[model samples]
Target chain A: MTPALDPVIHPIQRLRICALLDPVTEEEFAALRDLLETSDSALSKQLSALAGAGYASQRRATRGGRSRVWVQLTPAGRRAFHGHVAALTALANHAGDPD
Target chain B: MESDAVSAREALDAVSAARELNAERLRRPKRYWIMLGLMLAVFALLPYTADWPPLLRYSAAPALMILVAVVAAWRQPTAVRKIRLSGRMGLQLVGFALLGGVVIAVSRGVHLEQGWWWAPLVAAVLLFAFVAGVGPRMDRSWARRASHGEE
Candidate 1:
């Protein structure tokens, strides 16, 4: 077995962030906030943590002189998201199997 | 693409599980048959006399299917759960569906006829089989293992 490459995908919120971002090109802060059901400060904190881990990327854009915070997955983040998912699945399967 | 390049490994590793079971799994729709029937009927109603043809109509069925799959599957599940297919698979399936349509439309002509009837359905069935066939093996393996705290 490959030892099932499991990365520490910390804090449920950050995990959710990676999950949502894994498939999206880029998502608005508000949309992510809605999905994660977390406050702005909390979401930002998780996002920043993910950014530091190189699992995610954050860009601040000013449109019409208003700041826009965009959250996206780095390729690493996407893979981590997938791997995280796979490990979870593996766990699920193990639990479900009668054998 | 630099940023894209960096996270490629994680993306691959993460969705590898999804890819493994992607095609085999499907979401139950609110009105799946109704949706398919409506799409086919709408495509049928389109004027085939036009130059652009009615490829879009034929193409709509799979598109709607993919859309529904995305919406239904779009959610965050705690407990380290893997997403069913995630976003990448959805986009790929869309492209695949479009490719199927283009090939059929070009070969069979845009008119609603039975020229390439088996192609799309066969393709779908084959894909479904590919996914479904692998299900048992996977069930016996990692998915089962994971559930038992083997991970």
Candidate 2:
């Protein structure tokens, strides 16, 4: 089987979320929604998946008289992302080897 | 037969994507282990007979860096999830930097009387400060990621 077959993070949106999140410590809610090109509902769904898996954290705060939200990888999230990527790489490697 | 064919195609695509992601995850651990192993090996070569002060100074960096890296490797992402700008940790980190700087200056003023042993300590503190201060701001996208749970 390809390394991507079994992953700590599976869903495409969730993986995309991790991809965007892996680089920075935290990111803005609306800004990310724009980048992901996903609706608020779609993004929320993916975020919930990650949060439920203990891979990320979310917080709600207010600024400039408006509600704001933020998200970041927890230590566990980082580990999981790292593992997921590893799983992906392994799959890729296996495909090429074919031995 | 069209629906059946479509189902098979979807399964194939899903499997391929999963493989790709898993492969990427392995890269980090592989690099970490190789680097860590090399460092451990190099440290083992330091003469057992070196002077205490110099040894302490020299050992400070590699020892601490390796220790920190290992600890970070071991930490699940959940462990650092709650990092926040609480006044206490912020103050403590700032305090550490201030203390290190003051000592470094004082030692220099003493005509280098104090072995620059604390330099490595300061570097470590600086590294930690950068991570603590900058890490959160950089990965802010996780907010959206976490909220967009599953579809």
Candidate 3:
């Protein structure tokens, strides 16, 4: 199949979020923010956008006597992220092709 | 077009770095493996405790197993979002079980308690060694697979 870029994941921050989330079963919200070096509000906005697109979801859980938000990609989100990566790889590889 | 390609390549590099970082974050501490290895060693030695009273022999292994589980949960790192055993780890566990079973069966066949009471003890020691030696490598392999989106 011809790979196509996903608009939802095309933005740099959102794409980075998906890249980080794709590896693990779930990640704590604060950890994600720390890794991405983005503020809570900005990370939340990006996550909300991904969640709105049905690509990601978050849940609140109490751990170590504190409430923490955990985020994970939905199955659809994983597929979309992988597809988006494949599209990017294709585009990058095409750079070597002759006109 | 050239600039777009450069950016795409850069983005892919970012993805690779993210995966590597995630894998590193998922790596467990040495203490975790030591505790786990000790627990597993005790579990392997349970069969040798058959001569003990029924209550002690039957309950000890299960109780220790539960304690291990509780400790593991309590000490789970925040970086480890969730524990999903990869196929390789699962296979390693199955292999451990099979090898353990063989040790028990051989010990029984030779009536280890007669003059070779140390057979099971040796087996338990070997099992502990296996865990201590191979556990970290298995964890590394699992982390790599998970980070690469292969799990």
Q: Quick one: best TM-score, which candidate? A: 3
lDDT of 1 by residue, A4-98 (tens): 54454644556556655553467678767876667999988888788788887878899779898888888887677667666555554454557
True contacts kept of 2: 0.00
C-alpha RMSD over true interface residues, model 1: 14.0
lDDT of 1 at A63: 76
Query: TM-score, chain B only, every model?
Result: 0.28, 0.32, 0.73
List each candidate's DockQ score.
0.08, 0.03, 0.67
Fraction of true contacts retained by every candidate, in order, equals 0.00, 0.00, 0.75
* Model 2 chain A poorest 10 in a row by lDDT: A1-10
Candidate 2 docking quality: incorrect, acceptable, medium or high: incorrect
Tens digits of per-residue lDDT, candidate 3, A1-99, equal 769989999888898898888867788899899999999999999999999999999999996799999999999999999998999899998987997
Identify the candidate with maximal DockQ: 3
The residue-by-residue lDDT of candidate 1 on B1-151, one tens digit each, is 3443334344534444433332222222323333333343333333332345478656755676667545544662211224234344456547655654554454335233655444444444444443344433433343333322233
* Residue B124 C-alpha lDDT in model 2: 38
lDDT leaderboard ranking? 3, 2, 1
Candidate 1's C-alpha runs over 4 A off are A2-7, B1-151
Order candidates by TM-score, high to low: 3, 1, 2
